[model samples]
Target: MSTVKKTVEVDVPVHTAYNQWTQFESFPKFMDGVEEVTQLDDRHNHWTTKIGGVQREFDTEIVDQLPDERITWRTVSGDTKQRGSVRFERVDDTHTRVELVMDVETSGPVEKVGDLIGSIDRRVKGDMERFKKYIEEHGTESGAWRGRIKPGDTSGPAL
Candidate 1:
């Protein structure tokens, strides 16, 4: 597995940042290589991505979530094996620090080479930068779901 971590400070309140993040369907707007994200429910999502002409589809479920604080998820089904979390921190009333940490498994030599060459890290960093620009320009979240889900619990109501 390869671990990548990145952070970006956006000119938006913590809640604003967190709320936008919860709207997983909007990720492709700013997240590079992400073709689409379908929020299957409040805690599950299906993702489509293409990088270097290779496309992948995956399903992931949120493992833990705390409104305006953090959201964590792990892959449930797919060839892409990974887990990650995004954290929101208040820098002030109008600024937020967003941190992302992910651990991914490489199933083939192409992916393994990309990981070793720091391509994954650079890609994530670019994603964070794009997110910062996106929120700063939009000035508000498109939508939000403030529901909470405890780790390992899947009985929560859908969005």
Candidate 2:
């Protein structure tokens, strides 16, 4: 497995950043290479992404989440294998630092080569940058899922 970490500071409050992030279905609007994200339920999702001209699909589950603090997830089924988390920190009332850490493994040649060449790192950095711009430019979240879920918890607050 290879690990990648990227951080971006957005000029938005922690809640604003965190709330925007919880709108999973909106990711593809700003996240490069992401084709779509379908929210199957409050705790499950389906993702479609393309890399190196190849398309892949995956199912992910939110393993844990804390409003305004963090969200963690792992792929439950698909062509992708990864576990990751996003953390939100209050830099100030008007600033928040968002960091992402992911450990990923691939079973395909394209992804393997990309991973070996540090493309994953760069891709993640780009994603964070785009997310920062999207949130900062919008000035408000499209929607929010403020529910909370702790580690090992499956069901979060009622949607």
Candidate 3:
């Protein structure tokens, strides 16, 4: 597995950023390579993406979530193997820092070579940067799912 971490500072409040992040279905609008994301349930989602000329589909289960804090997930079945988390930190009333970390495994030799060359890191960073631009330019969330995932509950995080 390979890990990548990226962080961005957004000109929005923690709550606003956190709320916007919860709206997973809106990802395709700004997230590069994410063809679609469907919120199957509060804790499950279907994702369609194209990376490095390869199209892949996956169902992800939320492993942990805490409002205005963090969201973690793992792919249950898919063309790729990965686990990751997005964390939100309040820098001030109108500033937030978003950090994302992922552990990924490529499916084949070609994909592995691409990954080793830093394609995945660059792509993830680009996605986060685009997300920052999307939210800041809009000045509000496209939609929100204001739910909380408490510690020790283990039923996946709330969105």
Candidate 4:
């Protein structure tokens, strides 16, 4: 596994930033490689993405989440293996520093080369910057999910 971490300061309150981040289904608007994201339930999501010219699908389970603080998730079963977390830090009432850390394993030689060249990290950081712009301009999230998920509850699908 290889890890990449990036941080960006957004001109928004911690709550605003955290709330926007929780709107996973809106990711396609700012995330370049994400084709679609469906919130299967409070703690589960289905992701369709194209990376390095490869189309990949995955179902992710939210491992942990704390309101206005952080969210961590891992792929339950997928074509690619990845686990990551996004954290929000309050710099002031209207300023927030967002940080993202991802651990990923490449599936092939092409992807390995792209990762080594820092393309993946660059893409992720760029996506976050776009998200900042979108949120600052809109002043709110497209949608939000304030639901909490317990560590071991797995049953029906409800977004």
Candidate 5:
């Protein structure tokens, strides 16, 4: 598995940054190669992405989440195998640092080559930068789900 970690500082409060991140369906607005994201529920979503001419669809489940702190997820069933988390930290009253860490396992030769060339790392970094710009421009989140979902909880988030 190849691991990529990236961080970006946004000109928003930790609440704003974390709230925007929770709106998973809006990811495509800033995430390169992401075509669509469907939030199936509070804890699950489906993603469609095309990178390097390869198209993939996947479903991910949020295993852990805490408002204004962190959100973690892993692929439940999909064309890819990966898990990741995003953390939000307050820099002050109006600034926040967003950190992302992901572990991905290359499936085929093309993906393996891309990983070796640091393409995955670059992509993730670019995504973070874009997100910074996006949130800064919007000045607020499009929507928010402040529910908390602890690992192993199947009932749902505590809204």
Candidate 6:
């Protein structure tokens, strides 16, 4: 498994950052490999992504979520094996620090080389930076779903 961790500070409140994060369908605007994301429901999403010339689609389930704090997801069906979480922390009245942690595994020689050279790390950092610019520039989220997902709950408020 290859792990990547990245953090970025955005000139927005924690709620703003967290709200933007919940707009999964807008992820492609700032997420490097993401091609598209469709929120199937409050706790489910379908993702289309291209990485290293390979395109893949997957279904992800939100396992846990906390408003203005964090969101965790895992692939329930997909061409890839991965799971991750996004966390939001309040820095002040107008600043928030967002953190991402992902665990991914890739098979094949090309993927192995890329992982060894830390390409995934670079990708994550780049994504984080883009998110910072996007949120700071917009000053608000495109949309928001402030639903709550408890630790053992698999469903959230309708989106």
TM per model? 0.96, 0.96, 0.93, 0.91, 0.98, 0.94
> Model 2 misses residue 150 by how many Å?
1.8
- Candidate 4 lDDT tens digits, 1-159: 889898989898988899999999989999989999998977889999997788999999997777788888999988889999999999999999999999999888888899989988899889989988988998876666666554555652223
Off by over 4 Å in 2: 155-159
Top of the candidates by lDDT? 5
lDDT winner between candidates 2 and 6:
2
Give lDDT tens digits, candidate 2, residues 1-159.
999999999999999999999999999988889999999988899999987899999999998888999999999998799999999999999999999999999778888898988989999999999999999999999999988877776556543
Give the per-residue Cα lDDT of candidate 5 at 145.
Answer: 90
Winner by lDDT between candidate 4 and candidate 2: 2
**Candidate 1 local lDDT, 1-159, one digit each (tens):** 888999999999999999999999999999989999999988899999998678999999999999999999999999999999999999999999999999999777778888889889999999999999999999999999999888867578433
For residues 10-88, write the lDDT of model 6, one tens digit per residue. 9999999999998999999999989999999888899999889988899999888889999998899976788999999
Arranged by TM-score, best first: 5, 1, 2, 6, 3, 4
**Which structure is stronger by TM-score: 3 or 6?**
6
The numbered model that scores best in TM-score is 5
Worst 10 residues of 2 by lDDT: 150-159
Of models 2 and 6, which has the larger TM-score? 2
Candidate 1 stretches with Cα past 4 Å from truth are 157-159
Clash statistics: count for each candidate: 0, 0, 0, 0, 0, 0
Q: Rank the candidates by lDDT, best first.
A: 5, 1, 2, 6, 3, 4
Relative to the true structure, candidate 4 reaches a TM of 0.91
Report how far residue 119 has shifted in candidate 2, in Å. 0.9
